[model samples]
Target: MTQFEINSDISVARCLSPSFYLDDVYFESSRDHIFSRTWQFAGLKSDADNIRPVTLLEGFLDEPLIVTYDGELRCFSNVCTHRGNLLVSESCRGASIRCGYHGRKFDLSGKFLSMPEFEGVRDFPGPEDDLAGLEIREVAGLMFVAFDPAGSFEEFFGPTLGRLADFENSNTAVSTSVYEVNAHWALYCENYLEGFHIPYVHKSLNRELDFASYDIRTFRFSSLQTAVPAELEKDSGRRQEFDGKAAFYYFVFPNLMFNFYPWGLSVNVVEPLSPTRTRVRYVTLETDPSKRKTGAGSDLERVEAEDQRIVESVQKGIGSRLYKPGRYSVKQEIGTHHFHRLIAEFMNQGGAR
Candidate 1:
């Protein structure tokens, strides 16, 4: 059944089915059912010097999309209305977008401006000739785009913006690293959703964090995982006032992770390549450059290596005939439970969007 139900009370709830991790049919269905309706990171407002065309979820959605600006920035389908040729093949600055194929032109804001050789066309330059615009929301320099979204921007990400109100100004570019992992996309996400494996999986990280005091707080479409540093680590007095000497990890709904440290913000985006493969992008925004050398955020490469290896191993193990769903560690699995419920609810919905 598509209705993969989970009990509201975590006390006796079973984990998500093994089939959800293995079947190609389910994997393909999730693209339209879940990802298409969710808000996705398009690019940063500060990312371009001019009008830029970007593909949404490149390998998966592969939707031709363009982000352009005149006085106002807009995100619209990048396909030419007359011939379906890509409108903007590269990042370039111009007052308007012109398809190289047939010279159909649109304003930078995506309004149909002119078309050559279409003088006799019926209903010429109607709304259909204009580039179709998607639902886009811009906040804190990040551009988010979604198609027939299941929820509003505020409903999906309001709490995150509220907590990170001070971060809006650090919209500058930073280091970005992308890693390809041989793991289920959800496996990478489930591992990131909770901190239960930190003590066992991340030895160096465990040293800086106080295990007993670490906590997970859940929201409507997101969850926050916070770890108070060990007393000696905190006593060093290098942290900023934000998060009050704790490292905050915010997991937004399905696949995005915002990791905050005194060093800055780390945006980890999990992109599905196939049912058993995933691409994880680590983007670092250094608000406080000096803090990069220490604490839970430091040595990210080492930590990422550790997380990736284990997740890949789980990817292999999940396909076993003997495999079965297990129980949740009620105290520590709050975020995973919330995630599973969302998967079920969203996936159960039809692929209309």
Candidate 2:
């Protein structure tokens, strides 16, 4: 067992124990309390365009979820009512979604349209037989879904989503270089919520950002890390120029990160695969093509590599017997403490499995 301690001297609380990261039972609980209850970025609004007002997004928290747009926007579980076959195998545009296996048809709203072979069955089109509906919400052009109907996107995102409202509505195109990284989802989130590791883990990034001037602010369920260049630190007047350096990082509750750079923006969605495995999906949003590669944020590949190396190392360290819950640096790690507190609160409420 690992020993844990909290430092009351600091303004912020310490992080959870190493067992929270390493224990399988704890991970299972988090899947429900944290992941299922929080809003998850499903895909872009443009994805629905390809399928012409209807697109199916697959693999949301290990469950298939479909998003459709006819006159209104809706999402439903992509599981068939009869025989439990997956409803939508691949994204397609059509009048209705029909299961390929049994030809059980469903309208855009997940209403039972018709079943080919069940003519003799009583109460065939009952409400219980209809597809399970999942809650869907959109911010700007990005779409999100929640398995728990009681969860509210506004409540889960809180001020983090509101802060980035302008950037979200900008005329930005999704970058082609969509990156998929393999790691524990929580580790990626932990790395994102703090700037404490920037100096040690990211040497090139440190050169571009003023480590001393980095500002971190905590909100209800999220946090922000703002970075300004060394030259611009003293001059608050020169903050909004296209070339002027600024990076606004927002971690929204459980597993979404919105990074706004002088160039444009990048959205990160963390998806857990198992207790020790996760997928980090990066979607870039930018209006100016030329500005995509500017500032310390330009070298995305290098920065991503630096982040991956440190986070994976931390994951390994947390599994060690010598490791325990660690204290937070009040000035540096308040965002991390905020995240841990939210996790504890949700778990205490029986949200965790």
Candidate 3:
């Protein structure tokens, strides 16, 4: 592990070594130490709707998991209980998950139901025969799961959840066009943590947001970046339309971003696909049913494309041999420092149980 002098000096809080971003060994270690223990946004509540016996959500952060709803919502290791065959092929509704390999069956709640070819084997169906259960939690319409049960979901996600309570209470339904982007997951997160690069990287976005009034504040394992128009600049002020209104970009530690606009919210869940690749799933939740197709929120596809271009370039740059760790602009990147520290803490704790 890379060691640093932890003191009052903001200069010491520069990003992790370039190796942390480039090395495969470091990436694998981070997956075990940090990602496994962290709470990951799995899917939206709408994804878990109806009487679907099995909902196969390809796991983020290297742990394969599936959420199911028969009578009760449950999360289980996607690896089958018998012979280690993967249970569900895709998202579909069924009475139970039947292993395609050997037809071993499991109920929606991950309880061992029955197996066809195990009649002669004594103690064939035991606890080991049941799908491994994972802790599942929900905030608003978002469903989250932690591979490690010992880690508290509330402790990890409380701040963002509290901030989102009011918007959730408005009962916003997810917009159908859920956009997905490819980039390094942490790159996406680091970008969202602060507005430092917005003016230079996001020309169109910079015009929309007031950079002078943009401020970032940190709360344990979470951070909020507030962007208000220069005209209506105050510590706190409200606007009618989302065009020049206050936008709160909330970064819940590890991988979730809740971007609050006047119209509604945009939830970005960053999922690491590989050492160098990632998928950002953007789910837009809108309360104003009629205004969904208009205003600032409507141009999501363009905004996402802009973000992808910049992040992908950064990903390529971080891998270069010439690159090393650099200083953080104390004025601009305190939130990013806080994020790196939290990541260090989680990783230093070692793997979760």
* Candidate whose lDDT is highest: 1
Which runs of model 1 end up more than 4 angstroms from their true locations?
171-173, 232-240, 350-353
Error of 1 at 334 (Å): 0.4
- The global C-alpha lDDT for each of the candidates, from Candidate 1 onward, is 0.82, 0.72, 0.70
lDDT (10s digit) by residue, model 2, range 1-353: 22233443456456776666777776777767666777777787654542322222223346776778776778887788888987775666788888889899888888888888787888668997788987888777788877772346766676767656776658777753544444566777877888899898888888878888788887666778888776676676646664355677888888888887766778887767665666677888776667656566688789888888777777777888887566778888777777766666666564432
Please give the distance, in angstroms, between residue 178's alpha carbon in candidate 3 and its true position after superposition: 7.0
Q: Give the worst 10-residue stretch by lDDT in candidate 3.
A: 48-57
Candidate 1 C-alpha error for residue 67, in Å: 0.2
Quote the lDDT for 288 in model 1: 78
lDDT of 3 at 64: 62
Candidate number that wins on TM-score, 1 or 3: 1
Q: What lDDT is obtained when candidate 1 is compared to the true structure?
A: 0.82
TM-score against native, each model: 0.94, 0.86, 0.82
The reply for model 3, stretches above 4 Å from the true place, is: 1-11, 47-64, 90-95, 117-120, 167-173, 176-183, 233-245, 289-299, 320-322, 351-353
What is the per-residue lDDT of model 3 for residues 65-177, given as tens digits with 9 covering 90 to 100? Answer: 67877546678877877678777656777777788998888887878898886768987777888888888876676777777633587666656777567765576777534
Clashes of 2: 0
